[model samples]
Target: MDNLTHSFVGAVLGQAGLKRTTGLAMPALIIGANLPDVDAACFFWLEGTEHLAFRRGITHGPPALVLLPLILAGILWAFDRWQTRRGTRPEARLPVRFGWLYGLAFIGCLSHPALDWLNVYGIRLLEPFSSQWFYGDTLFIIDPWLWALLIGSVGWSWWREKLGGDQRPIARGAIAVMLAYIGVNGAITWLDNATRGTMTEPYPRAYIAAPLPLTFWRREQIAQLEDGRWISSDWKGSDFGYGYANSDQRQCRLPDLTEARRTNSQLDAFLFWSRAPFASRAADGSVILYDARFYDPRARDRFSVALPDVECVELSAG
Candidate 1:
């Protein structure tokens, strides 16, 4: 999930009870919720390292989700206890208050990974022992509709509160809507999978379909298949194209196991954990890497490729 979504969820949780239980603790809770992303800072330190981006790494892992808040809570508690011993009366109960604070913070933080799992990118709910990626494949990385629905509902709730109308119902209703959307999308994806199986040889390898620019029109679906091929279709139209070589022409030798381990280790840990990883060398000698993180084959294009110093195409153009 995106940071905005995580923050919004944190804010929602704060509104639910964290704010009432501990006023200033809300910020701590929110930070804890987003703390898993602290690995993002790695980009500054580990430039050039594979997957070293903050999105994949310890901070985003399950271990961090479980332990970071507890660690933070202990530190806050210890600081408050120290202040109390120094004759700060208000600080005496700070440790006790922080217990609730930490609890709320943990919940807010966990929500991030939970939501992320809904997308094609996987999460390591259990890590250390395994790094297999998993995903529900129901939503796009960025879904305008989801953002609109959630933000709109939250905004409406705020408006209702200002007017002295009950707001909890609105918030609850919004959450229900979000859940319903997830369910409907999941069903649609399942149906899409069923449709995919009906195709004959040169099966579609990757695809993405969602509500398009137009509403009445069915969603647009784009796919890449085994051969150097492409297909685009919609609920309303059937269109296809193939321009590249067969699948065999595109095949290449993969990186060795040692290279795989080294590259995977270097990648954003969260991203590595979220996708099926593959490495190959293109005919032009460029490296091609694939992270099944995003279920779509288009994601396969994300792999790096080396460019030749000079080519026949350049000479022809000259």
Candidate 2:
């Protein structure tokens, strides 16, 4: 999910119990919600580390989402107990306060991965055992429609609260609407998968279809086993009749270079281990490699680059 969505969810969670509970607790909840993204700082020190940054590893994984909140809640619980002993008399009991704080934070963290999984970009929901990616591809990474609905409803709730109107009803209604939208979208996705299966079954090894981004009126279908390679199709209409298939093979093969001086050496190893390796040589004689471990072959650009100077040196030595 985008940062705005994560922060908005955190803000909503903060507003939920903070306005009703002691106002001081809002910061903790918000911080905890946004903490998973703290790994973004790696971009400053680690050049060519965006793939690791976006992989949703330990910090955004299920273990961190579940355990971090409990650890934070424990600390908050201890602190509250000490404050109470010092005659602070906090409004809520220690357990109740910690529960709300942890619950909100956990939800905020979990929301990031859930929204990310909805996009074409994959997420490693079950990490450690398998880095294999699972993609929902129902929404775009920065879906304007989803943002409009979520932000608009959240803004309306804020407006109602400011006007001294009952905001909970609006918030609850918005939540219901959002849930219903998710359900409707899920059903549409299932129907699309079924239709795509039916369309490709007759051809069998000829065509493959997968859900595209943003709108339900389109899908990305491709041809397989063309000229000993797979070819991708353009986004076709929902009815499956408006796109042309690329006769050119889209799948890439490994280069037959004998040296270990490739630009994306590490990435190539990772890709090969993950079983979706492909190599392409550019006009400048630089090789571009890809790993299907992460969906959206476009992201293959994140790998390290081999300079023309190095390539020339190796060629000259040969």
Candidate 3:
């Protein structure tokens, strides 16, 4: 999920009455909720798909869940003390307790991976211990409807807080509504998976069946057939939104850029991260690599490389 969603969730929690627990409680919650994304700093040094190899991995794993929050709690604790020494602490600020801050930090940090799992981009919750990817396939990475619900409650809570009224009920209601929405989407994913599972037998290679953005009822299913063909369609219930792909671009190559992978470290990272990878040849014979999961005409896919002037295209026989 995006940072705004995470921040909104934290704000909702604070508005739901967690704010009374300690000074800087809201900051602890909001920042800790987005703390797992500290790994985003890797983009400074990492190029291309190196992000996939690292992000949402150990940072979102069980160990980091504990340690990262501890660090955040310690920081907030120090900040509060510093404010006290400077005599600039807010008059209404509650007494800061390390334990309370730690608890909030833990709650906030834990929410990070759980929300991240709600998207098609999977996360490794157990990383370092295991490299497997887990997907919720529930919410889109960004959902305007979700934004409306969260922001609505947050805005209402802010107004009520200023007016000196209990806003917990409203915040709680928003949380409940969001959870119900997630459950509905989960059912949609289950049905979508069941539908795609049946169709995969005809392809029998690799596939990704994930929820699309804008609407939870719709899904985008992309696959590579046993014979090196790519097929994609959007599903709403049992009906396909755009029908099955019949365009020339629908035919995809199961590219084996093994030698190329060996020569280029970035390509190696891309291959490791690509779930439904396929390749096509550019006019200059360079291999244009893509993950079928993210293939769309409107968005630009950048995983292409020069195929070293060799016959690298190989389709599965059986």
The candidate that wins on lDDT is 3
TM-score top scorer: 3
Per-model CA lDDT versus the true structure? 0.55, 0.53, 0.76
* Candidate 1 residue spans exceeding 4 A from truth: 52-54, 71-96, 201-287, 290-318
Alpha carbon lDDT at 315, candidate 3:
41
Model 3, span 74-132: residue lDDT tens: 99899888888999888888889999999998999988999999987788889999988
Q: Kindly provide the TM-score of model 2 when superposed on the true structure, using C-alpha atoms.
A: 0.67
Q: So what's the TM-score on candidate 3?
A: 0.87
Residues 1-318 of candidate 2 have per-residue lDDT tens digits of: 678766665666544434365333554565666667666765676545344534565566777788777776667667777777899856754344666667765666677777767755566776655666766756556655557766877788789888987666665665666667667666666675666543543442444344454664455554433232333445332211112242221323444544543455444334433323333333454544443223332344454233333222111100
The per-residue C-alpha lDDT of model 2 at residue 2 equals 78
Q: In candidate 3, what residue range of length 10 has the lowest lDDT sum?
A: 235-244
Better of 1 and 2 by lDDT: 1
Per-model TM-score on C-alpha atoms: 0.66, 0.67, 0.87
- Report clash pairs, candidate 2: none
